[model samples]
Target: MRYIYSTLGKLSAEQLGMILPHEHVFVDLRTPDKPGYGQADTASVLALMVPQIEAIQALGVTALVECSTGGVGRRADLDLAVSLATNFPIVVPTGNYREPWIPAWVHSADEDELFNWMLAELTTEIEQTGFRAGWIKLSAGDDGITPLEARILRAATRAAVETDALIGSHTIRGSVVMDQLDIIEAQGGSPARFLSIHTQAEPDFALHRAIAARGAWIEYDNVGAVPVAESTDLILRALDAGLGEQLLISHDRGWYDPALPNGGVPKPYTVVSTELIPLLRARGVPEDTILQLFHRNPFRAFSRH
Candidate 1:
């Protein structure tokens, strides 16, 4: 059985094959543009996702924790709808507050509005589809959390606490870490439930360790795509510091563009099963250790409401 756990009653970490804790199967920045904002159709989006979905299944991934939030062109209902049809074990869609790299025209949905909408949608999803939401995604740009972002975090915390779902975030490189930590704690969120993406960009073992010490998970995602030596060295450093269990590894991959030569997403960019695990194994990291980072740690941290 896949290990089933929850943050606030929300489920994640089903006992199964490998899981990609944070990723996007389909995203089109063009959807939120003017003239097509609310009018963006689901068919177009699904068309972009189908090929990759097939690829994911082929790669032996039993679950994919999609981090796309509403108001950012990610349709939870549509994604769930498709997942139901495919009978995939899980395709967890995030709630709202998908800022950063947001389309300029996505103005109708602010944090508060998105939060409210998210609650309603979540309820509907549970009642109708029986889809267990494994986690929530919130974002803060390089500047740190704003008032609206705080409101969203508060709402997420409340919902998470109530639902037992884990909270995951995208904190861009720079000074946003403290902001994220503050908001999560202020909302009575346990440090264990927090996941901040891309900590390797700053490469501060001390800082990452501090967060892990606080019971939060710090992701070293997007590192697998770099030169193996450099990436392995960083992973080793984190591990030596006793932070592996707090780690969550991923390529953060799966997107295709006609312009890109491979017709796939870039670094931090590959199907979860394709390159990440193999690269780590080749680098001399034990398979058990890698599984703890990629499979066990994420499941334990993210599922603990």
Candidate 2:
């Protein structure tokens, strides 16, 4: 049996319906040095996020993977508030983002210390929120996995091994997918429970195929950010190569930026629900396959057995 640890509580994998594998209900991407950057008020964020979530729910989305990790304006409390408001399950993560975004304490902590910290967050509650993280989220640089990023990744793998939690990584330029996998395997982590996020950024179908062949998951998130045709083509190419079971799709959307007036341009969570799915169907992708992409794949990706 497998269950997904959500902000509200643990839910059976079957309970995850039409999940958005990657999304951010509350995130502040503004630079910290500048005023108004990363300054989203909780009240305002809740007000803005709930309705958007409700709208996605109206479209039959039952769960979401809030990929906002530490040092990237992850608001676990905000995620809880929105989940409660909309009666939706949200699976949040515990880990750190790439350099500069990562906090000093994380950078200074030794591997064992970091591993324990992540393990605690996965098994226990995070910062008194009483919400255990569902997965470990990590980020690497475009050039490659930096030393700090590697440390975080290795620690995350160890934590996953202990907790049986999933690990999702933000791969820049898709350059270090193999290296990341090598480290996870070296640390005794299961590649099947790992996800190479932002995979479409690389546009190398062979790379995507290679990663999927290793029993890891490939995420084609960035739906609205990239052109729909190109994104769909990449997905179709992967499916054609018989990697559908190991594939995941999402918009990577939703963010309430406080820097601009009225929280900047709102990236609605409906792109995958409204635009991408319909496009896939019209392109001759079977309905069951679409269901697998939206529902089954997410359940397997987030669940801990």
Candidate 3:
């Protein structure tokens, strides 16, 4: 039997209804270089985020995977609060962010120490929050996997294998997708449990085909930000190549930016159901195929069997 850990508690994978594979509930993307940025008040965040989640739930979305990790305003307690308020199950992650967002402590720690930290987050409660992470999140640069990022990736792979958790990597331009996979397999991690995020940014269909053939999952999650036609085209292309089982989709949306007046225009999470699904249907995508993308694939990718 397989199960997924939510901010609230454990849930069977089958119990996870229509899922948004990648999203951020409360993220402060502002950098240290810019002052007065990346500041989020918990009360303010919950005040705004709870209603957005409730709106998503009204659209029939039962669960969501919050990809915001350490170094990026990942408040597990806030996630739990929203989940409880909306009665929605949210699967939060544990790991480090990209090079720019990574903290100094991550650089000081050795690979073994990093692995232990991530392992503990998966196996136990995160930083006394009493909320265990459901999966591991990692990010690589556009040029390639940097040396430090490689250490994090290797450590994340080891932790994922030990915890039977999925490893979702943010691969900009999809340049290092294969390299990440190589490292994971080298460290005894299963490629089937690895997810290559932001694949739509990479235009190489052949490369996408190769990655899917290797038993890794491909995610085209920039829905609202990217043109719907282009996003759906990529999904259809992958499905045509018989990679539907390994494909995942989401808006990659949501952010309560404190910089902007009134939270910097919070993007709605309903685009997947309201806009994308209708577009896919208009393009002749069958209902069953759509369900597979929105439901079955996410369960298989995120569930620990």
What tens-digit string does per-residue lDDT give for candidate 1 at 1-305?
A: 23342112344454455667766654444435445433334455456556566666777665666665654556545566446555564445455454544444334456556555456544445334545455677777666676666667777777766666667777765357666777778877776777878787765567777777777778866644576456667778888888887888766655433223333443333433555467668778898897787667766755533
User: Tens digits of per-residue lDDT for model 3 on 6-31?
Assistant: 88778885677799999988776755
Q: Which ten contiguous residues of candidate 1 have the minimum total lDDT? A: 1-10
With candidate 3 superimposed using the best TM-score fit, by how many Å does residue 146's alpha carbon deviate from the native?
Answer: 1.0
Ranking by lDDT: 2, 3, 1
RMSD of each: 4.7, 1.6, 1.7
Q: List runs of model 3 lying over 4 Å from the truth.
A: 32-38
lDDT of each: 0.61, 0.86, 0.85
lDDT of 3: 0.85
The residue-by-residue lDDT of candidate 2 on 55-98, one tens digit each, is 99899998999998887877788888888878888999999888
